[model samples]
Target: MAKAEFDTPQLKGIPVIPHLQPGAMAHSRPFVAKAEHQEPLGFPGELVDDWKTKAIDKMGELLTKYRALPVFLDACVKCGACTDKCHYYLGTADPKNMPVARQDLLRKVYRRYFTFAGKHFPKLVGAVELSEEVIEDWYRYYHQCSECRRCSVYCPYGIDTAEITMAGREILAHIGIGQKYSNEIIGKVHKIGNNLGLPRPALEDTLEGLEEEVEEDLGVKIRYPVDEKGADVLLVTPSADFFAEPHVDGLIGYGKVFHQAGISWTLSSYASEAANFGIFIGNYENMQKVAMRIRQAALDLGVKRIVVGECGHAWRVAYSFWNTLIGPFDFLDPKYPVPQHVCEFTYDLLQKGALKLDKAANDDKVVTFHDSCNVSRGSRMGDFPGGQFVIPREIIKASCNHYVDMAAETIHENTFCCGGGGGLLTDDLTELRVKGAVPRMEALKRVIDEDGVTHMAAICAICKSQFTKVLPFFGMGMDMIISVHQLVGDALVLGAEH
Candidate 1:
């Protein structure tokens, strides 16, 4: 294989977030507010009283069932083995951070409402009656932690807090308390086929602009084709990648690699977003819709392979859940079968000696890779060809000379979340977001201050966005964050050499 040509697009301004730009020159609209209507899926104003009542009853019913799940019941041993492992508890010294305590917020109710001991003799199991105050407490504490799986690593039973968190969100969504930021984005993906809701016209315009930029910057003519028939790969990514800082640069890198490799790939204006927020809400139907867009795009394009972009949850949904949710497409080419992650794609190229890499490209940068919770721990689908999340380390180590670990407690399965996992990456929740992120930010600060690690490489858009915000709060600067693909781009010895 050969090096792919890259199309460099002129980035006009950072998307959505104006504060990301420097000085007084940058202008961004206020973050979109929460849902205004009471409709379970729409604005609160359109919600009729009866509809609201039904939605409330439905939510209560779902919460009632989830509270009685076998995993929730049989998993806890009350061993207190998972105590010291919590990131938030370690950081804030809050007793609520303990895995047992966190689950007890729901589990206590579970025992009370459903268990044999509670029904027969309430006081025996420490089971209490559920009330409005109990619901309020669940709402508060479940949202307090970032749903990072640090505790699961130490849990003897592997009772994941993230699972509990998702369950809580489902209960919330049932009750109509779902956040507009993510829920609306999911709705947008369904309505317009992309989360940012960019239509085909704007998408075509962005691609054309990228083509022209490639010609200007790299003296290469690269094509970002949409709806092209019989392409080899259909590239799926988070919509934020199109306009966000550092992420768009990864797109440029993707174009470069594919162009150099002489691969036939196209971006789809339809099903453009890789994010599947339906997973957050536990709405299997919506999850299928999101994944179906990709499969439909692939089938329609006649592509042999689908290459997922760097977004973590997108890949989590695609690689982990797509096969089960919206699959059995035996028509796809069996040789290079199924959707492949960009990391897997690039890593294979390097492994096969197809693309030349300039190891010296990242030579003096002390970089660390953040294993996103969704991609690493949350994934039940097992690893890509190379390994689970370790491929990132292999790729990073291959490209950069100085690689350092961020304390033993926060790597691989034990890694701390960027505090923005699970659809909470909105700007409106700044204070709570920052507080929940205290553990990870403090760990990063320690590594930056002690180990002299300058840059952090993360694959998820949420992680990137969250770090871009929280890193500054800890008095760090912006240049420290980069996508894993950006590092790959720097290392790739392009056909049109730098």
Candidate 2:
């Protein structure tokens, strides 16, 4: 059996600039997808013999299709503004993990084939051919990126490394090279309506179990309705919430809010998943396919509105891309945006004094918030531009008596990824995931040491799961990372007079 060797670095309570170490993580490649995983997503079963030509041709096509790709490739002057902006670079000290260097991996290939100067004098422009080593580098480094877009925030040219990373992964997939975790899950969503491959019966059973538990604990009947055609709102959430701890608690919180609001909401077993892996791999068609399920469900169920749950990247796709990908959404009730985030819905009710909350229920623990990367950077909430950051914290403050924030830099748009994002959360990439979490864990330690913050709440399922798995390695309890709605569920007073 082959084992991954990780040189875990010690946390220093601050982000340090390490001496450049090339090839430090060049060998940290994820598992390649099998025939079954590739074929269903309309990719080749294995690496084709003409992979080099196919890869370059695919890159050219992507460059022309997405204006951001070509513009980003041509715009970067290599001024080094974003060199230290990436969490992976800060954690691993690998130069390749730097956003500029990572972009160059694909940029070099683009210049070599597409540019005039590169065809004549490739060396002068730092251009390289599409060789086997470059292909391997693409697999290793591109997967290392969470496509979180944190680097773009600091780039003087506004060069989005995430665009480059997504283009690179798309080209790789076009050439029959795909990451097992993401592609496999994409297949599951296509076949079974979720990343978990959960059938409708299993989902119904889980929701029934949750209803039973809530009734037993609170003496209240909170409904977890599924496939209820006449419901007013269709709730779409990540499949993890159907079974996973903390995530399920968040679902319970959402149910409690809907119950208290006296609004009818139902979960669509046909489109049960909110986490869309399609965006991770940069496949627009597949992404649209995953998103269209929700649109179809809404039309079929005759729901007046659609509301999304706590999943972060799913919220990004829903808020930013759904209208473009599967819209005009003319069939949905025109009063609300075609789809609204659950946080927005909950926060609006809080502002209107519609639901009663008991903040003292959370008085025993001091809490902090981890802004999941996609929510912080790629998407917005409410009517404001930075509502993505404000709404979640506002809800938390309303729910919990004691609330603190992580370091100012690590909390809002500058938030680091939980290290297991972008479909790299599988066991095969465990070493990379743990090492990547160092920067986040360091920020967390500061609050724990100074403010005695006992828990960190997040809106993303991946963030909650990642922190739970990695916090124990940092001398913290796995239970410290929790769902934001878990706090709401705790503090919520069901059936209270408004």
Candidate 3:
């Protein structure tokens, strides 16, 4: 994990917004997708001969299709509220990383080609022609954004920077410059049904191994079933949950919660992934395609309900977009939220007192929660406006003796991203990832100093992975990051055997 060589932002009580550095992160873009990576997602193998025209056509098509695109593009008044809000701009001191300016990369092109003012008086409108230089800028800065929508929270116009970033990425992809990390994951979901590309046979082996491992580690038998037709619930989780650190612990937590609650659930190899990278790349067709696999799995399994595992952006797509993209989901039980979050499910059981929890089991360490950005701003939990924030904390409290929050502004809907979202988690963007995490890391540092907080709990796979990789750069232990459900597994009491 590479730390920033540039003077990284200091962990101060309040972050001092730095002055502009014109091209600080210009060299920090991810690796471009090759022919093999792009074709499956219906993208060109590489940059096409007529890329400029294709890029413009794609932008025009997007503007027409998504009403928000045109609305956001036409909406900004340059109030600069969002200028200081983006973590990238604060961390990298790159003016172009400012949400409004990043939007202008495409907005300017839209003006030059589509608007009368920009067409006749391009210089007056800050518009530019669709040249290679502009395209290069799009490729560079757009990928630097994590699409966490933190700026949208402060924008008076309610402009969503994530959507603009997605549009920019989509335009780049149409020109055959798709990103390797996300495009490859999208392709994997299309072919192998998950990002990790673990086949059904491998998935089965991993789940079984997890079951046995859990029994040994915690002295309890739990079933992480797969492909069990007619099960009451179909567990559709990120493939990373099958075996990633801190993430795998969350996976164990989900299984233990289900075991104690006695909810009949099984994992689906067909729709193993909750993540829909189509939303990441701003490709509605691909997003819908990846989402439909869940619908297919639910029907095939004859399960009455669908429960998604811990994933940040995946939950956003599932909660906000699933119904529109691939929904009705009428075949599944109507009582549930179609695809319910594992957190919501666990929280519900805790509320009902359906399972026993030994909160003292977590007394050894103090805990704090990092609200995954997508869950905070993009979606909800348990039918409330801020249930996304409340439920996770409530669950952690139930399973722990001590808990703390970072800061009033830094939490809930205003939470900073884990710095590795919107497909920027690839190794190519580690510097951006490490530096972008400054605000979040600073918040955590305060809690550690003021409240003696030892562990930070997160629900998103990307959040867990990002913190695990980058925490050490700031002199924090990598293991300081843990899953919310991992706490539940720690304190959850299975039965009266003792």
Candidate 4:
């Protein structure tokens, strides 16, 4: 229960190999889910009497179901190719934070139960039996991984540690060992339809408030519609956008873009949240349940297109998984991609010169774009391979006078996670979150010092929320992190300008 004392290290603008500290973050663990959270997600209410056996059985089930799990466990030759790839390793210098080391936490357990060498001569193959101590180690270290897959990009055999991390969490959850933050949020979404648990009345009231604010500022009554049947588009954004700073600003920007495009769009209180935390906990049934809300909303609303707001993992689920999770979309119009990113929608408008944008509107500030991990590597945008990286920057450039990127190594597909991803954004992991952000902070610092960048814009709500909190720890202003569409809203010219 004692908090680990983490001495904040100074960044030298170069990666430094830290002394291996085995138990540095052993105490960093998330809250356990209660019966309410666990039962609703189809997990046991509490740790079963034979949890060790059940956990091992769950691991066996996962290995049989997912070939990647078995292949990754057997394939790693300890070549150290991925030793230096993880941001957590770079930040904390904990050897267990290294991707391969993290994978071994579960791999060792797999070997003991399944592999002959591991079962007979366990010490030689680095295998260990499934015991209470090993289970506790799983709880501590697996939560440290953000599932960013940055390490996989460097591995010669394309060994994805994210797969191992997901398997580890899934097995833990099966034995009544769920993380409270993610399970509780999933419960809320199941009950109230979004992560924040904002009710339909509150959602409508907030949209109305936004309508009045836009009318006051722009002198135009731009609509933030909710559940309006027969609309042209149904906007499914993260619930954080309804209340959180910079996220709310991006929501306002979406309203402005839709207003300018002269399209009829409504937000469904039924599917208000785009974020599917089910992906974080590696629960496919829950992920599908979360995703089905959107399909139902689209059906009920009779919307022609589905446009998602500024959220990272939500886009991945929508872009990559939705079709498989709840799709074929035969009931809706076929004009668009079935579901489209708000950035792609706005960028398409820019390409067609549909909206009147005054780039000088953002003249007072110099901006940089942060490529969110899920969007950058897990999914793609536009028609090309790297469009996820290109499109966001293009939008910033078109909407602002000055835009600079962070270090070439730090941006695009090689981007570091915002440190609060993969359900680790809760207050419980504050130390881990802050330490995990060291590399990103160093990268952002270089840009700030060199380019006079006043703000960094992100498309992910978690990124915005994480940066707003962690940036201050690095002596940067909390307000330095802005939403991408916050810039778009600023630079957009309304009322017959086109």
Candidate 5:
């Protein structure tokens, strides 16, 4: 994970709102998608001849389809409740990175095209036509956002800037503009069935390798099943879990849980990926298309239950959007939630006293949980709103004896982005990702200094990968970030075969 050198934001006591450095991150935009990646997703291969008209028309379409977009555009009174809330603004000091200013980039365009006051008294109402410069600003700032929605939580209007950002991104894609990191991955998911594009044979080989490795290490015959029809559960996880460090460990953890709980589960090569990049781009069609693959896989495999692996935005799509995008999941068991988080599944097993424990297994490291943004703000687990926060913490507590929290402000709904979400995890955006991680890193640093916390557990694959890559650049060990289920795997007790 070599990165282009950039100035690292100094960790000087975790400033809540650092002094402004306008244009400090003006150069942090990500690589745009090419025609090859865009066309399969129903977008133009490149910028169109009438991209301006197309962009404005697409905005109008979004405004009509999503009622909340216009309200967010019109509702801001410019109160500064969200002023200090964005991790990008805190980390990079670019004023446009401020949630309000970012919204204004699209608001002005909305005003010029759709509002009476903006159309007539355009200057008076702060309206501007959708010009090339405006599009440039939209591309630059929107890509900088992780779409974490932390500012919306602080705003009096509850104006979710993430939606605004998504609308802006959708408008860009319709006009022949898209981010490569997300579009390319979404294309892979559609064409080859996963983000990593690992085919069925390779996937089977990887699972086989994991089985042998687990046997060598644990002396237990844990199985990683694939395409086993009639299994009760279908496991859909991010492709990163197939091989990425910390992420792969979590995959192994999932297998261990299913084995011990005696729950029949299988992974579908047809719908191998849980992540839906459509949510990142704000394209409902593409999002739904990706989700439908999972639905099809469940039907084909005859599985009654679906469980999502450790991912931030992936869980959000599965827990919150799956019912709408791919349901009615009536063919599956009606008693169970349509799609469940792996944490929820494991927690249920633990609650039912189905799995034996050895908490001392994780005593070597003191632990803290980094609540991933999508899981914290967008989705829920265990039948409650904040169960997304509580269930994972409870799992960690059950697994490790020395568990503590980072800064109070940096966990749960107020949590910071891992700086790699919203499809901005590619190496090209490493500078922005590194800087955007400052606030969370600052909180993590405090715990390291005060609590001697050695490892941070996360359910999101993006958070684990982000911290693993950026922590080294920030003078921390890359291995400090870990998956929550990795801790669970460490503490589980296995007896001789029954």
Candidate 6:
């Protein structure tokens, strides 16, 4: 026999026993297979009987709730026109990753169990009855998706897979497999009024810490107040910003901008976290509970406007749900309304040339942007200026002299995911995480090898963390990831040091 690739492979050390057999992997076997039908994709032993019953019922309820919406009922055409647009499908060549296939994971069940067409003739509509296997598939595939909405950008009908993912997550929660990272954050925010569960004292400490760090870094006596009354702006950021890498830099950037702008802003020790996990769970009550604090904080402080920091999902929630959930933020300028995203806010400043930048500050490196899915695809705010998703390009251009594009095909709406979105930014799903990351890494690596990209600037928190973890697998470096604000902060030419 030919020698193995490795002269001394690690397996070579273990003696082979005649009776020994390789056992099946944990996720290899069907979790719930029928006599004839293949089971859905999911981890074995995760789908318990009691959980299945509750999950089925919850799925039924979601069909009822979602079907009632005009956007759902009137919007979908089932033409399969947009099926080829899914990044996961394109990347992995997995048929189920197709947008149509992914939606059908739930839509088929909805039609079979609830819709009139399925009740009349299920076979005609391809609506099959839900099985234990189907639930397993739901848990597996649905969780595989980041619900990034990148697919929706190319969809002619504008049917968002994110909506389907949300519906599926609601069902998962009923089955008790809801990931602890997001769900637990929601619970903490609901009880303690922040996702970090930073009570009054802890929050005060963080603010003080930020102040000390800011003073040390910039050599300025900057103030970071918790609940200063009658502030001009209420600055809200994700909890990760306070505790994580690159994100903390974004928070510091906000401070420097506010200092220069002569703006009065305060963080609410009450509602510190900008991320609202209610979006993840489809729990409107919890969503409202978590979001109410922002409005209340504004009311209490008598702030004029709420300026959300560099978070994608938080901006989506703030834009889509905040108005309906807790409103008449009528107190905000009528022209601007309740809340505005930091990118848009910063872009506006750049347009007016309000903030000064020294290109030499960022001249040391070449920067290209990763258009965050939630920011570019969800917001539809790219029409502002410069044709492309102007925010990223403009920010990079303004802050640095050496900014470049990631080839035309990969820039703007066609950009790939960092693979840790839709709350998959957890530590457990290592295998799936790397698998999901291949497409993005491939794209970045090509550009890095050919065009000489020195840094990959992005706006989302999960993208930063995910890229940091997975980039090395593709021969990229951890130092490659930097937030948009960090570049801005670095480039700022302060008039006079405080």
CA lDDT of each candidate? 0.69, 0.90, 0.89, 0.90, 0.91, 0.70
Model 2 Cα shift for residue 465 (angstroms) = 1.0
Query: Where does candidate 3 clash, by residue pair?
Result: none
Query: Which has the greatest lDDT?
Result: 5
Q: What TM-score would each prediction reach against the true structure?
A: 0.84, 0.98, 0.97, 0.98, 0.98, 0.84
Clashes of 2: 0
Looking at model 6, report the run of 10 residues with the lowest lDDT sum. Answer: 1-10
Superposition error at 13 for model 6 (Å): 36
Superposition TM-score, candidate 6 onto the true structure: 0.84
Residue pairs with backbone atoms closer than 3 Å in model 4 (clashes): none
Q: After superposition, how far is residue 26 of candidate 5 from its true place, in Å?
A: 1.4
Model 4 C-alpha lDDT per residue in residues 1-498, reported as the tens digit of each score: 425566666767765667788877878898889999999999999999999889988988988898998888998888998888777888887889999999999999999999999999999998998989988988888899998888888887889888888888998999999999999999999988999899999999999998999899878899999999999999999999988897999999999999988889999999989999999998889999999999999999998899999999999899999999998888777877768999999999999889888999999999998899999889989988999998989999999999999987788988999999999998888888888888888898888888899999999999999998888887889998898998998899887565
Instruction: Report the error of model 4 at residue 398, Å.
Output: 0.2
Question: Scored by Cα lDDT, where does model 4 land?
Answer: 0.90
Please provide the root mean square deviation of candidate 3 (C-alpha atoms, Å).
Answer: 1.7
Instruction: Give the runs in model 5 whose Cα sits over 4 Å from its true position.
Output: 1-5, 496-498
Candidate 2 achieves a global lDDT of: 0.90
**Residue runs of model 2 more than 4 Å from their true location after superposition:** none
Stretches of candidate 4 above 4 Å error?
2-6
lDDT of 2 by residue, 1-498 (tens): 115666567889877878888877777888999989999999998999999889988988888899998889888889998888888888778999999999999998888999987788999999999999999999999989988889999998788888888888999998999988999999999988999999999989989999999999999999999999999999999988888877888999999999999999999999999999999999999999998898888989999999999988998899889999989989888888768989999998999999889999999889999999999999999888899999999999999989999988888999999999988888777777888898899999999999999999999999888888888777899999888888998899888887
- Candidate 6 lDDT at 355 equals 90
Worst 10 residues of 2 by lDDT: 1-10
Q: Write the per-residue lDDT of candidate 3 for residues 3-79, one digit (tens) a residue.
A: 34555556776767889999878777788899999999898998899888888898889988989998998888999
In model 6, which regions exceed 4 Å deviation? 1-60, 67-84, 90-93, 175-177, 335-337, 380-388, 496-498
The residue-level lDDT of candidate 3 at 341 comes to 93
